[model samples]
Target: MLGNQKVVQAFAHEADAQEKFEDINEDLRVWSLKATFFSSITNPATRFVNSLVYASVGIAGAFAAVKGLLSVGQLSSFLSYANQYTKPFNEISGVITELQNALASAARVFELIDEEPEVPEKPDAAVLSNAKGEVSLEHVYFSYNPETALIEDMNLKVRQGQRVAIVGPTGCGKSTVINLLMRFYDVDSGSIQVDGTDVRHMTRQSLRTSYGMVLQETWLKSGTIRENIAYGRPDAAEEEIILAAKEAHAHGFIRRMPEGYDTIISEDGGNLSQGQKQLLCIARVMLCLPPMLILDEATSSIDTRTEIKIQKAFGKMMEGRTSFIVAHRLSTIKEADVILVMRDGHIIEQGTHDSLISQNGFYAQLYNSQFAV
Candidate 1:
């Protein structure tokens, strides 16, 4: 609500939002009513039963006393015993509702625990070390659903220290390429290799650590600026963190904050602007200086001026490091060592920007469409 309040109000969705809120409120109201009704009945029923028992004991005891069949002290002791026995039922009734809620929550938790993992690590997986950043996908086939074909017979090779840019329309497998390279999803019928070794044979941790990533959407946890910058390398020294922040052009803003690098950010960086969050994420990846990099529209959120600055910083960062850049903005990737244009999950055009544009094919058409007056 806080993040999107302006948007909601601008679109005149106040009524819709209120209606949804009331719907949730009504459901909760019904739930509370049911709980309250059950609780009220159980507690009062226990009390009523206890009271009736006490009344019966009193009346019978009085009759007995009148008939000289019971002592006053014995009658009082019997009444006290009956009260003690029924008191536990009242306590138990009070907690029955809470117990039911807890049991239902536990059942949901156990169901989540029992579900299978989508990507499981192997026990005997080899550790990828000192990678030269060579990557290749061989005759790859993958689909989210078994019956649907997303990517098929895909083949590509990326050499060490090369910058490969992927450009395509939405749902054309741009991000999926990054997922395959990162081993987030294994190819259905082929192999992805890094440094001549199949990725599946490498330990997931070691393979993932070899690459630094920055995405269009930024994610920052609740922490100080310094902590967020050092997320990828928690043990990074103060100097190292500051240097990376400087490289990413985030150090100036950090120092300007009320507490400098110590300024506490709210959850998901609610306290900071989108560009600031993106800069911090970029700083994190810069600090790691991984052998390979994956940048998925890394500068999309920044203004043009800031984007230019970040692109310069990214150019420096990508030096001698294999980088896979997935971007919708064609102009940002002109300097890429190789460009792969995808459509329908296939690499339809592959060349340098100038070479592909000269061919005057799909890549040329897309590029021209963007720059068309």
Candidate 2:
């Protein structure tokens, strides 16, 4: 049952599912034949046991009659009683195999119920409300394992409607300062506050709703284009959906399709290019227009020329919204209000682009290396 969801998410496609189905179907057929073979043999086996019991009683009766201890009519009646007893015994013996299979299935269900969840929700948790887009993280620390730390003693403050871009080399813990901001994972130490309320104090659902995210790993359900775009804002009108698509530079491509916004998208966007899928994700977030935004730029698949146009669409989306951007292409983040340069899970340098360039620090060196040909 869980495997079906993985197939729908495109970890495997329809062809793979078909192959698995045929394999399981063959196994089922063989198993059914085995059961039928056992069932067909069961009645004969019971009759053989019944005949043996009758023969043993008859031999004793013959001995008694020959010794003048019993009559022929009495011996026949004894044999008839033995046959009546075997009939009920034979009926019960037939269902033993089926009953064992049912008990084994029940045992599996009990095993699953005994397992515990990793993170249980807290009772009496409050709901986050009236988020004004201000986010602050102080003295944060986190680690996936005890031997290695991913984030340590991190502190940040962002006022409302600000754009902060994080840039770093590989393995620098650039796993979305944005993810932390949205409370995807809780920090081991320190507090993450949005609009002066700590995230842990509120329900995760309500807190996440206040933010809109567009990451490189874009996700959309298998449905019409319009449905994918309006996922976060399900009640959005057609005009609003089109406006959002236009703002994200997705409207043009969507219109040229055979059915426009009504066109169906295959799972994991098998029918669209990576760039096109990313644009649809952006459109989805735009429709919700959350007060906070997280944008992770995965530009490796995007051509330099194509990215220039996409960045323009991003600029308009970021306007007047508190956003955190993670980018490898330094050019896309040159205009950020603050650029944080991270190294090995630590923030090494931070400032505006020009200011960092003036310092000739880590940010400057990294930016120069990108253009070194």
Candidate 3:
């Protein structure tokens, strides 16, 4: 773990260094190109001046030699030596300038290649065999920065196939809890265990493969509608893609498109409505069929009518799966098995919706403030 932290710090430092080097190198190249052009013009002028001097000397010598005042061999030798000397100097000067510029470019390119990855997976870490989705956080502590704790001494657990909702004000560490569970960032102290196995001991790829996520922002690559839905399982049969889309209530809009399943989606799915995009994201997650699902503000951006439709789709998707829903809309998660109210890196209250409402504590206040709307 110490080695891993060192590697992460080193990689971050290298990335910063590379960015600075590239910026400086780009400025150097531009200046070098202009310098080369000017040097080309200046070098010729210097050679021309040398040639004129040589020519004047040759003419004077030839005239004197013809009058028996100088020698033909001596004049020929002087002209030959001057041409030989200036030619090499002009070529070498240009070569040196060009070499400096090329060196700077090469340095920037190699620096980036030399950088290590920010997060490195262990070579022989165990692959999760059958994750039961039983997660536990024991006295967990975490912070994206050293001075402030995002989650501190927080303890929680969920049984297999449990549906939990985390609701709180923005920046109260609701997402941080999900990030910790996903192992996106390691805890500063304590342990996060999944199915009795410490999450840190599992390979990142296998750990993440156990859970599926649908974010508020639906990121769709430029591709056919069928391709986006089948993103999680590219080899899924055509019928499977159609089934998942239908479950998400996205089939109607997709069918109306000119090409149906084959319709091309613009980059980031810019052609689709916000609700349609969210539905597609849900469809993609459904195709993966992970044991655990994470919905991070999954319905925040859509219209109320569309939100209800997507929420229904989420209900169907969460059946029999261990699900974690992070949202600000309390009504959307009223049916969750457990609700956690967080504030300033701590879980201030947790229970079923009815229980928390009866307590009239932090959770009750939050619900009354927002759900009353």
Candidate 4:
């Protein structure tokens, strides 16, 4: 919960972390005190109940002896026999109470076990093998909620090694198409095929491993530059790692660091600037060189000069690989073999950059809006 304070602070939420922390601390205190109180009483409570049982039996035996219905020696023997039974009864009660607490903890474990997965794998699914990177989405449909439909009847196709750009305003289902293609969420009514096989039929590892992705929001682990770049292919050679970083224009900055590529990044690359982190991410993907690529506004964080260099690296990376580019920056994908314009959960326009500009449609409006005086 203390970790949550960072997020609250980061977003400048009105909620008071200290106030919440005090309340939670009070709850913890109460819980701990209650547990300690229960534990402290267990043995004493058992002894108190044992004494009551013994006293009642002893009193009854003494009265019987006085009436000449029982001998003094017999009373002693009866009290001894009673202790054997009552002692176990007291111990068993304490054990039962302790087990109840343990069972409560076990129930939490079972809750995790009982949770249903969002995507269940098919029985006897085949591993996707020898992919040529021909991707197609045939009549796909999806919605996060029934009332707020996102993508409806979306169809797309990309021949092997082609670079296709998806352009649209936010919430126009461009990322949804990528999600469906990756099987992050299955389409409601249609199929996403990779290399002539439906994504559902292949192992998620197989399908995802075939694609190399670099997103606008870069994610990096706490590791050295070399380790982060070789994350995808951990066995990648040192020379190959350097080559990838050089290609992505990352090597120069990395070399200037105190330990060069050996410098360890702090959590989420906090030690680095946003553009530097993005360059590392691009280098990481470049090292892997998967047959298919997804660049989702991948250069948005970089300055114009860095973006130009990274774009050149991307040009090399996309060669002979089927690539999908999702960009709000029209210039980044101006040379794409196909440009798809999305609006209101549908593909409204499709063509080359020049062809789409010539048509003077939604794509033209979006492109022109970026440059409007």
TM per candidate: 0.80, 0.78, 0.78, 0.91
lDDT of each: 0.91, 0.84, 0.86, 0.89
Error of 2 at 100 (Å): 3.6
- Cα lDDT for residue 287, model 3? 83
By lDDT rank, best first, the candidates go 1, 4, 3, 2
C-alpha lDDT (0 to 100) for residue 347 of candidate 1: 95
Candidate 4, residues 305-352, lDDT tens digits: the string is 988878888998899999999988898899899999999899999999
**lDDT over C-alpha atoms for residue 334 of model 2:** 93
lDDT of 2 by residue, 217-259 (tens): 8788999999999999899999999999987778999999999
Whose TM-score is greatest here? 4
Consecutive 10-residue window with the lowest summed lDDT within model 1: 116-125
lDDT by residue (1-373, candidate 1, tens digit) is 5579989999999999989989999999999998789867887888888899899999999899888899998899999998999899889887887888899999999999999876666778889987899999999999888988999999999999999999989999889888888988889999999999999889988999999999888988898888889988999999999999998888888999999999999877988888888899999999999999999988887788878888898999899999999887788899999999999999999999999999999999999999999
- What TM-score does candidate 1 reach? 0.80
**Which lDDT value does model 3 have at 230?**
92
Candidate 2 wrong stretches, greater than 4 Å: 1-51, 61-93, 118-120, 145-148, 298-300
